[model samples]
Target: MEIKDSVVLVTGANRGIGAEWVHQLRERGAAKIYAGARDPRSVVCPDDRVMPIALDVTARGQVLAAAELANDVQIVVNNAAVSYRQPLIGGDVDRIHAEFETNVFGLVYVTEAFAPVLRANGGGAIVNALSAVSWFSFPGMAGYSATKSAAWNLTDALRLELADQGTLVVALHSGAVTTPMGDNFPIDKIEPTQVVSAALDGLQAGQTEVLADDISRVIKSTLTSDPSRYAAILGG
Candidate 1:
């Protein structure tokens, strides 16, 4: 849980939240950061602690290879995700499939591949990047919401499953961040650096879930009493 001198791996580290996580981790004095990306060459930070690693989370072979390469990694930040602006009933099936491939299935693959490594290293921790959409409906991001909801449950399951091994699992849910993923939205967004910084602090403090923005904090607090409030947007 300690970020200082921790060996960490961050997926989708080329840009957006993932890239910000890499930078923040270095600032936290991480011993090494495996910056996992589809094209590792794109990671341009000059820090020696940053190790750019080629990893396509959707590909089983690539994931296994990355695990082999970053054998010392004790903490994992599953920050890679894909979102397609599509409604469940009206969206293209191909787009929905694509989102699931990266957002849900890919996360599962990465976790599976890294589980042994984490256990071997004395069971450190896993932090999954989720979204506020998992708690409430967004008009055109139903597919993304569905996948993130699955990821949220996945985080819970992993937490319980890995508990005996002493591994900590943290699920982070938040409204849009000021990254490429939220560039098209008009809502107020938190900076990616701030989001990642808060996440690291929460992890070290042994928190299970992190609501990185006010919107996410309010949604999580209100979900139990007003689950139906989200249905209003879905026309329930």
Candidate 2:
């Protein structure tokens, strides 16, 4: 769908790629932007067209409330995510649960609540911020990687399920992003604009999945190999 003049709701709009999504969507002429953050006051609206929403994607009540409030939304950008430096096993179990709560279930709640909203608004689009980790487990970030892998599956399943309604479901995959999320990475990272621009380009072209960087493309391409090669890329 053309972003120009469309109404959009982006979760985790306070910082990182979500913040860039707000900026780029505005640049693309979106008529209204509902910027959602855990603390509504943290959302910096650039204009009256940008509405701040108090949303914690992990909270089903908040997700449903946002859907109710942004009834005219034509696009939903699920950009909220949390990660931990813990492994899937033998690490901080609390951190692992927190990761799943925000990264996996949070996304599921947002998609479910907004599926009908999008359907009501003539079957719009859903943009999910996935990662290269969605394709392979990073060395020490196994817990975070598992949630991303779950997100990847949901992205694919959502595309198939929402297809009949003409709702476009897009999976945006990238490597290290130059955001707080990418902090301390030993490898190169892409700017937030790079990620948002690529995603918008794909969304405009009606693509169901977008590899926002060469690293993501490489990770995806090597998925069928017996042993994934991303470990080597990260010097694992």
- For all candidates, the clash counts are 0, 0
lDDT of 1: 0.87
lDDT of each: 0.87, 0.90
Q: Say which candidate scores most in lDDT.
A: 2
How close is every model to the real structure, measured as TM-score? 0.94, 0.96
- What would the per-residue lDDT of candidate 1 be over residues 129-235, giving only the tens digit for each residue? 99887777676788888889888999999999999988999999888888888864446788897789779989999999998887787777767646576543333
In candidate 1, which residue pairs get closer than 3 Å at backbone N, Cα or C atoms, i.e. clash? Answer: none
92-173, model 2: which lDDT tens digit per residue?
9998888899998999999999999999899999999999989788778888889999999988999999999989999999
Provide the lDDT at 108 for model 1.
93
Clashing residue pairs in candidate 2 (N, C-alpha, C atoms within 3 angstroms):
none
lDDT minimum window of 10 residues, candidate 1 = 226-235
